[model samples]
Target chain A: MTPAAPALPPALDILGIAVFALTGALTAVRMRQTFVTAAFFALITGVGGGSLRDLLIGAPVFWVRDALVAPVCLATALLAWFTPVRWWQGQLLEWADALGLAVYSVFGTMKALSWGVPPAAAVLMGVVTACIGGVIRDVLAGQPSILMRPELYVTAAALAAGLAGAGVVLALPPALTWAIAVAAGFGLRGAAIHWSLHLPAHGGEE
Target chain B: MTPAAPALPPALDILGIAVFALTGALTAVRMRQTFVTAAFFALITGVGGGSLRDLLIGAPVFWVRDALVAPVCLATALLAWFTPVRWWQGQLLEWADALGLAVYSVFGTMKALSWGVPPAAAVLMGVVTACIGGVIRDVLAGQPSILMRPELYVTAAALAAGLAGAGVVLALPPALTWAIAVAAGFGLRGAAIHWSLHLPAHGGEE
Candidate 1:
């Protein structure tokens, strides 16, 4: 089944942020932190990756310059607060995370390229954009980061990012390349989620 | 007692990195990871905050483009690997961390100012420079970040950064302000280390 490919600009961005913020808020709930802490967690997780990307690529940080970003994150936190977290769990959460990861990976790579960053670094920037927010969130919550797991998390991002980079190098159309990259990334992560796919733990040693 | 005011460029930079790397490696040793992991931890903690600052300020990341930076970190890691961590414990490490923190806070603020970042952000840039590397180290090592501790860690960074920003805004001489900022940061952190000073936690109501 083809996941809906979101091609819109700021809306897609907002959706991704809201989903990630929801996840961060859920984590705060698990930690028994206050609503203030939940809002902080939501805001950070929502903006964290793009902020890191903008910083690295020497662009004005996306959230800092945008007044609406904060409101969107805060609203997302409030939305999560009033809702039962069970509503966000299971396949729906996984699917949303997969989409966010894929889209952000593509967006980050494209932005880095626009900034004249080197190609390889641009690819890595994609992974950074999709992952670092959760790393920051997990660190703050004193939990092991999802990246620390043996899963296909970063691998999925890398596939999307690397493909986009290669497509750029090959002079592929931006629209087509983005579509392909997102689909591939989402597919990989979806499979991992369903099948519990993971990298070998400790060099496959006993 | 006055800490050594080493004004040399690159030497001071290397010294700061090496000391920070030593702390990262010691964390790894405590975590009982392999030497390679220790080296990875050392390199990341040494460069994490500066890397973050440079990225945010639109400067080239220092460790990325520089040859010496990696070597300094690796050498420090190797040294830590060979030494008994007990040798690194007690007051000496605290002193070194304090010195590194102070110097980095000043450097970060100055760099942000040079990049034309706003005054408040520049002050925050200072705290980010000195403290973020340790936060990253703590997170990667699966330990609660020192940031979560009720202590003067960030407060010391803020004092140095804030004073420097104020001085710059007041059109004070750079050298004198830099000296004052570093000294004040070092003194505050040193006092905390010596006296076990900390911020009040959660009303102490339990």
Candidate 2:
């Protein structure tokens, strides 16, 4: 079965990579790491999960196959280093993070579907591809994974992938499905960040 | 191609599981975690990767399918908690670890080959299954992975798996191949742990 490509504009992909790289650099700054270490972290955070997924699926890794990603990552790291804005500042970084989440979710879902994985497995791949990089970054930086918190992060990605997969199953046009899914993810995450929305605490003893 | 089953008695499997669980518990104690946390860490470190591999390969997870593994793990954890000897300093624990590494590597390779994976991929799977549980434990504990260290752990597993795969290709008797492979792995890892052997550091300044 031919995998349907998502209707992602090239600009969206580039934006996603750049934003994730910036987040990585910002995380490094918080950890008081050197510039080279920051850059290395940024690159890995931008591409690591996709690389692992590609290796597992026997697909040509996009980072190795295409030269554009590396340069974009480096540029983003440089930008993060020189920015007057503190990495922890709420507004700009949050928006960038939301955008990255949306785009990465779509990209991951599309890639997994292309590999002929079943819809459920493909949705799993999508969530993993979008979130595992950040999880790895957090682990390396010795912080709890965002998923461990009562955040809507994984939930947002899951929603996006589920919608995309549903659309595919319903025979919707690929472009329309992708656009709606990405919008749904970005919209939900953006609102959560803006309003500080979160899941209710379980209040159980740890 | 038929995968080779280890000639080592089933008792070794029980012993390996117990020792690894003890190691996991000791490591958790070193972190000064709570009992529930320690037990969770022990269980995951004892079985997570192999369980994941079984799920992927459509095998009944040994822990879930067989009645013995859970009891063995629970007993190991209890022993670690109550034993007068410091778990970390126990010589039998060291021997059990070596034996576990050998048996698990052989078992992982055989399972992969049974699923008809390519030999190289089977070898990779073996290394992943044998060592990934420990990696997951270290990551959760905020320690660097064994793979990041200049260690002989993964290398030993890979070599054993490769030798076992070669034996399969050469049509050696399954039992003989398993015996030799297990010995090769156990001897290498035991010597490394005994002598503090490690790979030379790489990625020096160019």
Candidate 3:
């Protein structure tokens, strides 16, 4: 059987992997962990959600098919470990994270669609793939997960994925649908970050 | 088509759920978290690995089909929260943990076998399903996972699962095979806990 082509361009996937690795390394740094620990964190953050998604969907050769993702994660981890604080405290990292979120969300949805999952399930899978790494990172780092926070994270992902799925249903071109999804995800997430917008808190006492 | 009967006795499954839930509640207490956090942890610990396994095998109505699991988890969490530490500590908790590890390991292996997974994969799944909850709990509590430690934890589960798989290959009675596997797992874990025997630590530079 012919090998399946990747759902997204190599460049965007690598960028997303690198950004996630940077985030994981940053988390390890905050925890005052060693270099190896930081690398392990970065590796998991880059691939954990996607690994789970593939395993659930019974994708063949789950990790091996993505040649660029691991190397990018490793490089980013090393860079994060060696870079000075002043260099990292910039808007570039934030932008990279937004881009990563968008790319990963779209890619995740496309993979689910390829698996022939229903549209609703595909959208849910997209959100899970985009947010699960961060959720795992927070949980492992002993911080409250973003899911537990009154945040717009899941909502943003859902909106992005819904748009993409709708595009698919409407028979829009795949490239155009992906572009629209990525843009929407990035736009909403960037706005949330800029405006400090969050979901309304529940009133019940803990 | 009629649904396949559960592989084990309903009471045993319920007992396993309760034990895991109790362990999770105790962990939450150690972390000094609120009741909600305790409940959440307990529920996840009781059901997380099994839910994951079912999803991977494409089992329908994964959590909904298991009626006893959720209630047992909730009940055990409530019990642990209310019970005095003096009453719940020492041998009582240890015994419960051993039984839970054994039962859950066998349950996982049986499920994997029914799914026609290879023996090695089934054993791996057994160990993962039995122990992933504790790993998740430790990670959430910001401690090293049991798997990362030099422990006999996974070894015991693997041995038990291997024996069970062999029994199946030889066409031995299923109940007898399950009993042997459970005994091997629980016995080894109990002995290790009693004797404080563990795998040797990796030598680190001073």
* Most accurate candidate by DockQ: 1
For candidate 1, give the lDDT. 0.81
Better of 1 and 2 by DockQ: 1
Query: Where's the lowest-lDDT run of ten residues in candidate 2 chain B?
Result: B1-10
Which lDDT tens digits does candidate 2 get at residues A1-206? Answer: 33454445787777887777878888887777888878987898888777755654445677886779998888877877777645458788778888778767777877777766566556655766777678778877878766455567766876787787777778899889888998999898888887887754322221
- Candidate 2 per-residue C-alpha lDDT over B4-38 given as tens digits, one digit per residue, 9 for 90 to 100: 53333678767776767777766666554444345
Tell me the lDDT of model 1 at B141.
80
TM-score of chain A of each: 0.93, 0.89, 0.91
Give the interface RMSD values of the models in order.
Answer: 6.6, 10.2, 8.4
Model 1 residue B199 lDDT score = 61
Q: Which stretches of candidate 2 lie over 4 Å from their true place?
A: A1-7, A200-206, B1-104, B111-127, B141-172, B175-206
lDDT of 3 by residue, A1-206 (tens): 22353456556667777788888888898788988888888988888778766654446535667676777778878888888756877878877787777777777777767766566556655765777788788877778876555556656776687788788888899889988988998898888778977765322222
> In model 3 chain A, where is the ten-residue run with the lowest total lDDT?
A197-206
C-alpha lDDT (0 to 100) for residue B155 of candidate 2: 80
Residue-level error in angstroms, candidate 3, position B109: 6.2
The residue ranges of model 1 lying beyond 4 angstroms of the native Cα positions read A1-43, A53-58, A63-135, A144-206, B1-8, B203-206
